[model samples]
Target: MADEYRPEFIRRKFTITESLDEVLKQMADRYYQGNVSLCLRASIESYREILEGEGYMATRRIERQLENLVDEQRTLLMEITSVRSGLQESHRESADGQQLTEPSMTNEMVRIIELLKTTGDGLEFGDLVEQLDLGMHKVQPALGRLVDRGVVTRTGEDGERFTLAGFSQHYLRSGP
Candidate 1:
């Protein structure tokens, strides 16, 4: 599987006027043809030489920009993992006996959705039940209903845990 997905990195020289966006686009275009690690190593060495000749101030600025880019990439990766987990859980529940059947969003579910939207994180089942002052049985059914409507999505390997799906954007932006 790993071998099948290996990205090909290409070696190329950058002109003085080329923008970072252009470089990245070129890199992406060539990344699927061979060993990306070698390509990146070569690119970094070239960049280092360029920066050294340019001076310390430019080097430091580029380093800072690279750090910011790395941080942004890390954040996006984390969010993708979270969303994938939620979708996985939702898929698992497709075969489960329990299904969401609440007639309408309860005030508690409304509150839970609001909290998740504001924080961009889902609550654990125990925490949600406690917060809403509801029994597990009641909360489970209500959550199932919300999941069925595509407003909430589960996130754990077990079907019992859930998160607000991206569709909750509608509820958050438009209100109940």
Candidate 2:
């Protein structure tokens, strides 16, 4: 019972010529503590080293591929941003054009209408200049156009205030 219960080790058999056996024995003696088991362990270690060196090259190739993909993504993102900026500018122009009764209405005219509708008592020349982000040269011309179109009204003895047109009844009742 004790003999049958002993731990077992697998045994292997190999066939080799007498000359090859001598060479293996010498190699085992030189590097493997003169033991055949140590000789097999050394061979396995050498194979592992070779496989790992090859795997490192494969890993480097995969890293380069990933880097190229990231660069492509960055380029795509920049193009999208540029296209969006241009679209927004054109859309703003088109939207302003739609606000006018006539297609001949300029960007300045659209700005005046939008500004006038927001203020209760209208705006002065200086206020229009500041809010419109334009100079006196540009603002005066646009205001003139609006007056001619009956789209704006100039008030006060000095004509200092400017208000929207078509709201006279409401403005007069809510005055001062």
Candidate 3:
């Protein structure tokens, strides 16, 4: 009964790279307050959890896949929350009593908006091509998309100029 509270430890040692040793030391310092032994034990429990159920490589692979799926679930939840908040913000009104909107834009559209900002009235199609360094095949489709979305305008004798319009702010936002 006297020895019941006393714990016995099985010790093992393996060589690791200097960088790994440094990382372990840093983790111990921050999380365990320099309790390296406790840190090691906590880490080894990850392997123990996998092996205890059914000690096989297939079991380990399945557990790792489940862990990855959990991580992806967390990521998707964060994205959904972000989209909900953006929707709420879009419905808000400004101090001037004008409704503010959040426009969905791609990376290329954001770049187009930024380039147009550098010009005074607007940028001609040729200017966008020169500044953006993209082929006509790419730029034309994106311009057409923006014009359809009403976030951009085409006003000229033959519709040669493409200007960022309607949207209050650049925002420069994109996501899944």
Candidate 4:
């Protein structure tokens, strides 16, 4: 399958100075039976030694520069990983400490928490208001404040439902 497409052969033209043309003509007449392609190939082959020497030196210099750039990229990646590891460690430590330090809950928050604890799954916005016998204006702001404090999280597709922040991770995993 891979061998189906064969590349087209392309011949490149090289312009020679008058002096070089004279030399190529003399060489062709003496040996190559007036074939210009043969004379041109031979003429180009004669310069391989000097041309290859310069190309080799240039390639070596470029290889060294590429090696330096690769080394720099590796070092940068290591530094980024180290910084990320440190940040994760600090976050874990802080999260653990937060459990020990509980913030004071408001009256509405206390009621919401109690209701959330009673329900095994979670509660939607309308359900919360209906159960608590509160207006939408009062319930919305209270829930918003609780969410800001991280006491509760808004879940579900439209984020119309609420649940205890810690407990939500378990029950709300399959939903929003």
Query: lDDT score, residue 63, model 2?
Result: 99
Candidate 1: where are CA atoms >4 Å away? 1-103, 157-160, 167-176
Off by over 4 Å in 2: 1-101, 168-176
TM-score, prediction 4: 0.37
Residue 54 of model 1, lDDT score: 58
Error of 1 at 160 (Å): 5.0
What tens digits encode model 4's per-residue C-alpha lDDT throughout 113-176?
6677666567998899999888888888888888887767877888878877775334333433
What would the per-residue lDDT of candidate 3 be over residues 12-83, giving only the tens digit for each residue? 888989998898999999999999889888888867866676446767788999999999999999999999
- RMSD to the hidden true structure, all candidates: 21.6, 18.1, 18.5, 14.8
Clashes of 3: 0
* Model number with the top lDDT: 2
Candidate lDDT values, in order:
0.65, 0.76, 0.72, 0.72
Per TM-score, the best of the predicted structures is: 2
Clashing pairs in 4: none
Error of 2 at 77 (Å): 59
- Any idea what lDDT model 4 has? 0.72
**Residue 60, model 1, lDDT:** 85
- What TM-score do all the candidates reach, one by one? 0.32, 0.39, 0.37, 0.37
80-119 in candidate 2: lDDT tens per residue?
9999997565434232223333457788878887887677
lDDT of 2 at 30: 93
* Candidate 3 deviant stretches above 4 angstroms: 1-104, 167-176
